[model samples]
Target: MTNNKNQNLLLRSEHVWKVFGDGNEKKTILKDMSMSVHEGEFVAILGPSGSGKSTFLRVLSGLIPPTEGHVYMHEKELQGINNEVSIVFQNFALYPWLTVRKNVALGLLHSTISEEEKEKRITDAIHAIGLKGFDDAFPREISGGMKQRVGFARALVVQPTILMMDEPFSALDVLTAENLRHELLTLWLEKKIPTKTIIMVTHNIDEAVSMADKVCILSSNPGEIRVELEGLPVETRMQKGSDHTELVDSIYQIMTNPKKNPQTILHDGNHIPITLEESPYQVLPQIGISKLKAYIKKLMLQGGKESIRELNTNISLDDLLPLIEMMDILGLGGVEENRLFLTELGDAYAHGNTEEEKQILKKQLIANVSLIQFIMQQLEDGKHTIHTSDVLKHLHAYFPHQDAIIQLKTALTMGIYAGLFSYNRQTGRISLIEN
Candidate 1:
């Protein structure tokens, strides 16, 4: 962590903690997290949904303060918004009424610099981000790729010491995203932009591996630094070699196995075991029963067990991880040594008829899932039906604010599928079907 560039200590988190809301609904988003960035580095914060990757990035840039800890920039504790950092948002945050040049100029709106200096910086930024001819183009007049270029231009026009991006390419088309990444890397690696450091937050493991000098992964249920590793070489990250493939495969294992203290991959050629905290109140994956059945059948087709990485060839990591974790929770199946397999109950359910499948799921849900049990108790305590909002209040205490509603939807998906609860979609009521 030495800074050999003879520059300032760019950024660091000191036992950072972030909590949202208060009372029972208050959820701790980060816990005792400590990390640092040096000058001349592109660091990526990598994690799943609700892992506080975006929140951590905001704290690092001094957009928000940690509830209980500290964020430091240039070796001094930061109190408010750090003027040295610029954020390239996930959504292109251009003013709809403004032309590209006008939007880029907004970056310097409050500066005391002369209009002459402002115009030069604006022109330079637009040209550097490949938006020279599009200065007069309004946001609606440009394509998604061009709009993001305008975003980069706006951030660059500030000429800040640190540039932070939050999933900058996630909103673009595949080819356009690829082109933008190449352009952005040129700006960073070739020093085309005046920024001394870059910090980005992303959920894509390959994106982190390919773009960053350092990649720090955060684990969920009160996000903490799970592991930090130096990124792979550019040639190795071209996604054409065995090294790239193997490293990506290893990362997939580490991410999907979060409930355990997963012994993860190599760091700078040395193997390390990062003991991560377990997520006890793990949120349900936003998926349906049909996908679960199909995956179970797929597992059986593979002779009851297969490498999860191989099984995930056509599926996204976001979808696959939740599905596997759901199976593990239900006693239907689990992962062992990086392989996914059906438990005895799962095998029986896989072979069972439709009625038998529901019965097995009912038994598992009743025994293992507390959320389902809570719903049944609620119905028994007062009435046969409960408003979804009432249960959502309980859910919000455990999950992120944005994901609380999703947790309810997913809970009901499994609950209704197992015949434990009946949901009224129009009325937003959940009734106990069995108790």
Candidate 2:
């Protein structure tokens, strides 16, 4: 019975390979990847761009079948979209023509249930997603963040046991995205409904480390799982920075080093054994990962979690090194190496040890890094969101500072108030979002 239960895998993929082209020249995006996410576990598949994380997600959700392997849910092989699974994409695939109520109800359109029951489910989903007041609002009229809520609500209305998300917060401004992440975590924790499993694909490492019970790191190409790390929930993780930071460092090592050890692998036949011994970071010029690790630790200790560019500037590194920059930009360190520190926002988030809480906090922090910097820069400039050149002028005021360009640009694009800044893509002028 125990074996049966384990075999009745909530979701399983064996030897999955998604090949795009035909024949011998076939391009394999996801190769020999097999993983099982049990019922009620929140799992995150993380990787850099083009890492096939998204492809893996689509296969698991039954949106696309793997060219090589097989997928099973409930121990029964899945041929198409699993009845127990629902996917939420980064684009928030809400119906522009439909109202929020109708959009959610669409999920159950194929069901034999009556209209009354459908409306009830829709209503419940709306409230669950904090869109009670906006039920009448069309997708076109609402903010990008709110539209995503509708998409989530629609997915939830079907009452799927598993949730598959792909960068759902990628489109929103930092504050709005953070707010959504919190709401989603709260709902997931409250267990108002029966969502037992969540498998999300994200480019954001911090999101993976914070929100997932288990984080699977995929290599850049061929999309293999380089490392799998467990995350403590937000409640438990934040108490000790050293321990958590170390845990993060280990994950960073797994990612930065292309070489994988046997310890990182699952014994299942689905996982591939890549025998490369060289570290990925070694390919780049040396800036000393330990130095960066120390720098970030020191910065976080002092600033908690502040702007990366500001922290880097304060530290006064002679060269604006790319490797360290990449580490922090990826959220492996408290501050992006030589960049920002953990802000008050980050400190509050790092406090959570639970995957759900950490995920929420991670999402919030990553999205807002730019927003916070922008806000701070605005305050320094004695005005709210202004044109890029105007901010550049302020950066120039900090003349002779090596990070003048890096700081100003990051501030403009990253941690600012989204509602307070509007960029005219055509004109190249940035204005504040009207309240």
Candidate 3:
């Protein structure tokens, strides 16, 4: 709920750095980041996958302490679980055994408010969130949408000064998510809830643009703030106007290719382009060679050429971006402006159903990916054998432990599909496949 007179600064972060691991394996998730949230504003932290949007939100909310720097509420240092805030998670995160009314009570578990007030709050919250009749229902009995409604009620029942959501609608289907987005915005704009401010983390461009009063775009891999956008008229929001379309396009461009100068594009001279110095770590996007081949086959099925919009159909931006980006990175796919182009090798692979595709992909990986080259050399040096854990530990020099494990998994998938390596999942070992 917005209050024009309550325009005072509510919360802010200063030089915050969130690092995981220690010593030589240390990886910084957020680097020297600082931002502010004022009263009566909906702020969206938007970024790509592995940009640490969730990590940053946890740090901002004081759910976890930052490794360096401070978060201040009203200019005072915040310590351990910001009491004024409440969060709704991406997953419903409800207790299956608890009834809706009882589940909502968890928000008041630490509050000193009397039992009568707590009951009234629960009743009001359940009604306001459109789950009035579901008070006695268990989470297992409700629809996915209703489960999420209960999530919102629990967060709001606390009467928080600041409300935060981490991809709250991500788990819902398209129609349900759209409906919830509208409902929440109505509640905030109509002042139905007591929350003075709202902060959300999302990878969706349209969701951020439609919902947020201020949009802070974040760059991946160290998750730096790329730009802060504001001043869109409230009336212009959610409207299918030129302004809305243009804003979405510009944001899409920035998200897709962060290095391009925003001011020079389309001769507008009125945009803020992202300009982060990309790190050297190889972020092997989780889409492996088999999936890549499937996409290529799909593209060939459509036609030799498909518009970007056509390819993006039925897929969310977060999932689709990594896949197309990986293809471009591996020199198998090309996107120039709005059109998608398949490489000659990619075309041939699409046409062939046999080992010809694997042979072509092997040559492509060896020529393009340095990580593949490094892994191949290690296999040769280790007498054509190595433990997957050993390679994972070696990768920790580049990524955090969890991320390094995922990188190894993606690389292994690519190596297997390319016929360049053999991996025994049962034994957790990798061996070279010399011709």
Candidate number of the best TM-score: 1
| lDDT tens readout by residue for model 1, 82-123 | 999999998999899999999999999888899999999999
> Candidate 3 at residue 268, lDDT?
56
Model 2 misplaced regions, further than 4 Å: 1-8, 237-244, 260-435
TM-score comparison, 1 vs 3, better candidate: 1
For candidate 2, what's the RMSD? 16.4
Per-model root-mean-square deviation over C-alphas:
4.7, 16.4, 4.2
Over the stretch 93-195, how does candidate 2's per-residue lDDT look in tens digits?
8778998777888889887788888888888888888898997888899989888988898889888989889998878888898788777766776667668
**Candidate 3: global Cα-lDDT?**
0.81
List candidate 3 stretches off by more than 4 Å: 1-7, 21-27, 48-50, 95-99, 113-120, 132-142, 219-222, 258-274, 278-281, 307-309, 315-319, 352-359, 374-397, 401-435
Ranking by lDDT: 1, 3, 2
Count of steric clashes across candidates, in order = 0, 40, 0
Candidate models: Cα lDDT each: 0.82, 0.63, 0.81
Which run of 10 residues does model 3 get worst, by summed lDDT?
262-271
